[model samples]
Target chain A: MDPSEVEFLAEKEVVKIIPNFSLDKIYLIGGDLGPFNPGLPVDVPVWLALNLKQRQKCRILPPEWMDVDKLEDVREMERKEESFTPPPSPYYMELTKLLLNHASDNIPKADEIRTLVKDIWDTRIAKLRLSADSFISQQEAHAKLDNLTLMEINTTRSFLLDSLNCMFKLRSNMQPGSGTGKALDY
Target chain B: MDSQSYLPVPPGVGMEENFLSLDDILLSHERLPSRTECLFPRLGYLEKTSDSQDIMEGTKMELPLWLAKGLYERKRRVVSVELPKVYREGWRTVFSADPTVVDLHKMGPYYYGLGSQMLHFDSPENPEIAQALLQTFIGRFRRTMDSSQNAYNEDTSALVDRLDCLERVLFRMGQSGLNSFQGWEKGRASHLTTSALVLNYRKRKMADLQA
Candidate 1:
């Protein structure tokens, strides 16, 4: 899966925005959104929020956990633990990128948050690679991918699956009669 | 994942060869050292070393794997296939000791494929050979995985130079995964790009047109 595809999925996640102009509650197929009032925050999908932000329609309220102090805590927890801890949000990486890229002005300590997220990402990726190596070396049939995000899985999916497939084929070769019988039948 | 102009039929990396696979076809052409258990009359031309009208019984010579496989049968025993040096005890020890050191491109490029195919012939060393192949793969896998996943946005020719064809395929798989993720992380995946098929497809040159 593409990261953009994952980001597109993430765009469906709801975020808070305060629109300057007043508008009545708008109904959509997904759900009812926004009885926008000046200085009053309303819940809307991230795609809509970004669009509104771009047009100078509203000020996006970064998610509760988007703050640097919280992220720094998350990073510390992530580094201390051997396995993954629960992420701040399922779409933390995507949301960080989208919010920072489009509306850095609204997000306080944007640079610090960016660096912390990157550090967290680098640590997680390193753990992911280490686990993948052990998985391959030990010849584990299946592994439970706890706390791994879709984007994280997407990066290693092809490589891991292909390696497993290759390993399976090579392992299957150990029993000569299995393939030999099939060969004679052919 | 990137799409190619054609979906290549992957090699039948087993004792059984896939008929349509180009790798299997090429593998079939690999020569095997063999000794004939029976005579081949008027087929001495097949053996350039012999001037006789008929190939004598018990004569030893090299034959392509396809020809050898066809001529060999356990019950009839028309020919006997010898284990390749790579599959013998000496090389097996070398492989088992450290698989990463040996450059597989210089050895059997189809090391695993050919090794699997070797089992078709009845030989005392079949079990050992099979074990060696599996062990070698398991041992070399970490290196292949590390290099494939880590070497991003760089010239990979050095990393790829030592890999066998099967490992090369796995390496490319890893590379594509890494590259796609890196591209996405760099915020380029959102941008529209031309399909590789369209990019590679173009009109022939004037020289070709004239020819």
Candidate 2:
């Protein structure tokens, strides 16, 4: 077999495997974006493409997985993202929506989130900074981790889930409102 | 009792003549001394005949209580006790007690006003007196310096230096007094003034030390 054909077949196999695996199970294999044959199989690239066929569906349907919008919409969307989102009880689709919107805007909600996390992280960092011996003990580490703010940790957890969902939704050829949703396994 | 008998007696007949001519009789006449003669023998005729004439020669002396107390207080040994009040009272009691000891012409203004003088300043003639005054001043200064808490650490060096300078000046004054002035009469005023100036400098130095 030709090396290029083998490579292409491997990529196809990886794409096939993406839908069967849950979002959490599908690792980002390589490159800045993800495991790729140029782009994800469905929603993300189609949503990203500027051409009319791709652009029209994105504008009309606005995939639940696609996050980016026009440059003018960026600031307003970022402001919405920063405004407080109360975590849903037992974590629901609405909480995922909030996290997806925040991550999609790509407007350093991480830094804002990090700042929010700082109060939780500060005592740990201070102890680390002061500790004469370089490494933190396991008990100290666990104590610090336990002390992390619920809202901050929750937001981070939701963001991770949203990212995984995007990867899954993109790879699996899932369209918006498609009811293949298996209870958002992990 | 007769008017004619009262006339001046014959040269040797009257009692006055008898008393003068009868010196031996008069000497024998006083078996007991006369009351007036015994009380004030110096004032009476006994002064003329007293064997030790020098004992009755000069004026009598008695000291009033205030003068005695003032002298006792103003004594050199007692000056430490007196000096504070003396300084406070403008050295008036000190001057009154020993006007000769401390020359008023030089030290007068510190105690009293300069009167009508154009240039009013302290005068000291003896350097010893000046040094004594300086010592007293430094003593008071040290007392104040010890009690005071303000900037004591910072002022310590400057205070010590100024005190040293004061001592040097006082010593110089003393040396000059000894070298130039012989009698208290010439230098008394200058000595007194110098002493007062030393005291004033000491006060200023003390205030600085306190600060």
Candidate 3:
């Protein structure tokens, strides 16, 4: 599997951690982590943070956009536009899922966050379906895409390519019948 | 919540693959062996039986699943040569206590589709073969997602490669009309879009910086 957008976001996303113990700098494959104080908050990638949270060794501070109202606003924008700017992180859904799965207690209004994310996802998916419908109907070789994600691209790729290839094959087949090629063969 | 446990199983096509075209199959590096040799010779008359007409004493023949099963039932052990080392290992792993990741692509989608067609014929004797492959595939897929989730601190290229491979597998699965990936669809889709957003943001940021 390719590195998902979520993975990219997760790598870049820094989480505030209140560690249970002080430790020297730890080196990870991607980068290095610093010496920690017991009470002091240090930044770490969301992936490491989630692992620590799961281990009950540290507390993770959720990102700014994780709030219910903000997510609702983003959802509203998504619903209004054919393709609008997405929320801050590509890893938003994955992060939400991970945090909710591993550290729900650490997040305030976890239930509300879940509901809002679900609503946004549904709305966006519906829009994507509509776009895909139009894309199919248009039957053009090319179409401008707005705010298309890798998921939507992956979903539509085979269908689009197959349809286009079929259309081209049909066209090529028909051209032989309509032209001098038939007469030459005869 | 393990969302997978709650997914509505999509309607399964019993013995047909309609999603992929012949061209797609041909283009892909998926092919059955040119010839498959039968290990166990005919007990009665190799030359006399109606079903054994295709069988020659020494030469290998690439028999279809139906013919192969008919021969097998009659005690002609058609040696299964098409199954790759990975699949054999995967099958063994499914039986073992700890099963590692199985590369479904290496097993090949067309090959899997072929095997699925013969499921009805093969299942009576070896009931677990097909089910184990399917279950292990799902498990591996779930693990792929989990790995992606945990890959934040990993190299970007490796992560991208994993995601790219995943997208391909997901596409093939879609072609098969298998609802198995339903559980991961929302998350996968969301992850893709999120990446697009990040790219767009980065591009805009670069433009601003240039300005």
For model 3, the docking class works out as incorrect
Residues A80-114 of candidate 2 have per-residue lDDT tens digits of 44222222222122222223333333323334433
Cα deviation of B152, candidate 3, in Å = 30
Q: Cα deviation in Å at residue B27, candidate 2?
A: 99
Best by lDDT: 1
The digit string of per-residue lDDT tens for model 1 on A17-41 reads 9999999989999999979999999
Instruction: Give me the runs in candidate 3 sitting further than 4 Å from their true place.
Output: A1-12, A144-146, A171-186, B1-181, B185-211
* DockQ (0 to 1) for model 2: 0.00
Instruction: Go through the candidates in order and give the C-alpha RMSD of each one to the true structure.
Output: 2.7, 47.5, 19.7
B142-173 per-residue lDDT for model 1 (tens digits): 89988998999899999999998999988998
Each model's DockQ score: 0.70, 0.00, 0.02
For model 3, residues A81-162, the per-residue Cα lDDT tens digits are: 7674665466666567767877888899999999888787667655655555454444445777656554444544544454
Q: Pick the candidate with the highest TM-score.
A: 1
Better model by TM-score: candidate 2 vs candidate 3: 3
lDDT of 2 at A159: 23
Per-residue lDDT for B1-211 in model 2, tens only?
0012122311121111122333223222212111110132343343444555333423233322122222222113211111223333346445435333443223421221111010111112222233233333323232222222122224344323333222222223222322221222122222323333344453357767788
The best-first sequence of candidates by DockQ reads 1, 3, 2
Q: What is the TM-score of each candidate against the true structure?
A: 0.94, 0.12, 0.46
* DockQ of candidate 1 against the true complex: 0.70
Candidate 1 error regions (>4 Å):
B201-211
